[model samples]
Target: MRDSVSKDTLSDVKVQQRERGTLWERVRPGSLLMLVATCVGALLVLSPFLLVVLNAFKSPADYSTRGPLALPANFDLGPLQSYLDIIDFPKALTNSIVISVVVAVVGVLISVLAAYAIGIGRIKMRTGVLAVLLLGTMIPQEALIYPLFYIAQATGTLNTIWSVIIIFIVLQGAFGTYLLAGVLGTFPRELLEAARVDGASRWRILWTVVVPVIRPTLAVLMVFFFIWTWNEFYIPVVLLNSQDAQTIPIALATLRGQYTVDMTVVNAGSFLSLLPTIVFFLIFQKTLSNGVTAGAVK
Candidate 1:
């Protein structure tokens, strides 16, 4: 009887114990599994960056001889310099930066206004308005390409950087508005009431009270919008026909041939292209983390 009780206690303890060798506690079977899955996902997401950095320094001869997976015998900046010259990289980089920054700022403003109206303005048919914006986002860009192209041409903005920036501002704004409206809907009413009770106007309240409270979330949105616009390829490729107006993603595609691609040169350009966004993300990462958790805290 004593032996059976001791064995049963040990079994119960083992069953309740956290699964070892992983970072997460095994509160249930799902938690340990989720930890493993997250690790795999992080690695998959980071693999492309690793591959680009690895091959970017390799010479064309070395890449062809050793295949794509092997380590480089020596680092060479020749491919990096050559790729930069081939694509006139500085011009592309500058154009990309300007367009992304403009879109991010404008997009955030549009989202804030739209969200304010939908979330707190006591407007009629608020759900309808949100539904329309949601539908706009859901409609695949492929289906709207023709209409967008025709509009751009008619406006005489075709093949210009403005075309890309304008399109992204509208697109990004719609999504941001949809997302931010939800955030604003649950805003602290006591704060808004206190502001209004103190004789503040609506616009003043927004900029001073509401905007300041949600500034971290807005920063996250701006960073994401900037990155999204920076990575745009399809619309820019079609609309910005002029080589001078093309963004980095479009410029990268121009290097590929019908039959073959230069892996070394392309990787060098990819590595360079990846750097600015990485740096931008790193700078804003803390703000992003805070924004993500802000809603949970209060």
Candidate 2:
């Protein structure tokens, strides 16, 4: 009995030693170097955003005269205050929110349906259709501008928000077809075959089975579309001629004059413009990660 107890004691001691060794291993030189490097990179990336945040709180005089690195003498909302007045910030915010939500929703709906058709449905001429879609992606927007312009002029869509939204949804089809089709192709064939065997219609199977399985990919695509459409400058600038029809990008760019610049209010408006994309990415980062992993698992 004593010999067995001694052996047990020695085993416990060895386990404790191993635990300590592992803890020390985690704190070694290489690990410490990696930790430091990550922290430095994060700080460097965040510095510009921090500067903007700090500058947004400074008065125009403080912004021009005070050193950027120096702590503010006092936090002032004058920059933000002035921007709200000049740009009609509240109205612009509402416009941007409505445009982004509509574009994202419509883009996702159209793309998801197209992807489902191309991804899982077996049909003749599918390869031909896919080729055309991919060819559309290869055609640069710059190259197509003339045709798009003629279409807009002919359709009476120029200088309108509908023009922007319609163009966004059509542009989404290319990348959207490719991305979502790839994701849907990864679904197990057995799940689909089993669903069909159980008498579920194509639409029913899509809603009940396929959608839940590929929801992560859908979330990733939605967030991606939202960011791209929100930051889009060219399409909106070209299509929206009037100030009232203009989105945030044009509004912000117009803030800078030919002879003089209003850095204070411009920075504030730019910061505000970045908020939607930032919030979206942060919110959907986890689902994005999961979608990538789920795709890989297939």
Candidate 3:
């Protein structure tokens, strides 16, 4: 009887042990790994921005003497104030804003229309055309500096804001269209067909159906174009000969001198240059993750 009882208990315990298994197995390893990776990536990308923001509030003495890792014992707004006064911050800011806004808006608009035409419209030799467009995106713009210089000079746009705006639009929009075309290609043709069945004209369909559905792609393009245009240094430095036509990037570069660099003021100016893009992202960043991803998938 005692042996039978012991055997029964052992059997029941073995069954329960089999049911318990490992908790880790219940949670997906891939998901856990992805979460860890995403957190690390976020920190890596955002650390520089955060560091600049923190340093913006530090005095020149504090920033240079103390290590960057150290926190300011007392927050100071004086550095930003002094820096702004020292560099005619308002004028630089206005130039940056105007150029960035123009480039982003125009680039996205033209790219959207162009991408739609290539992706959905029955353009002749589409594969060949798309191949050409791909080449345009891959080619380095630096190679065309002299050609652009002559063109700008011939067109009488040298040392003007319009020159920068126009160049940026064309440069960034090509790449923007490349990305949007990929997203647009993933869209279902049935929707366009249905719109046509309802007697919607091509223009109407593009404006109403296509634009609304592809807002995600457009939003992403806008953010990217704006950031690129705002940060553009090379073309502006080369083309812009006058201070009045200078963008924030050019203005910030001018902060350096032959003898010494103004670390505090340069950091302050750099912080200012970043603010517009940061604000734009904060406003529309949802498109980056969900909207863009969903549109691409759809």
Please tell me which predicted candidate would have the highest lDDT against the true structure: 1
lDDT of 1 by residue, 74-118 (tens): 988888988987898888999999999999999999999999999
Clashing pairs in 1: none
Candidate 2 per-residue lDDT, tens place, 1-298, comes to 9999999999999999999999997787988999999999999999998887777777777877986676778977787877777786666666666777788888888887888888888556777877888888788778877788778889998877878788788888577887777767666899989999999999999999988987877887887788788888877787787777878888888888899987878878888877866887888889889977876775
Greater lDDT among 2 and 3 belongs to 3
Supply every candidate's count of residue pairs whose N, Cα or C atoms clash at under 3 angstroms: 0, 0, 0
Looking at model 1, residue 294 earns an lDDT score of 82
Q: Model 3 residue 123 lDDT?
A: 76
Cα error, candidate 3, residue 26 (Å): 7.5
Query: For every model shown, what is its TM-score relative to the native structure?
Result: 0.86, 0.86, 0.80
**What lDDT tens digits, residue by residue, belong to model 3 across residues 197-292?**
999998999899999987876777787787878888888888897888887788888878899975666777778888877788888778788665
Q: How accurate is candidate 2 locally (lDDT)?
A: 0.81
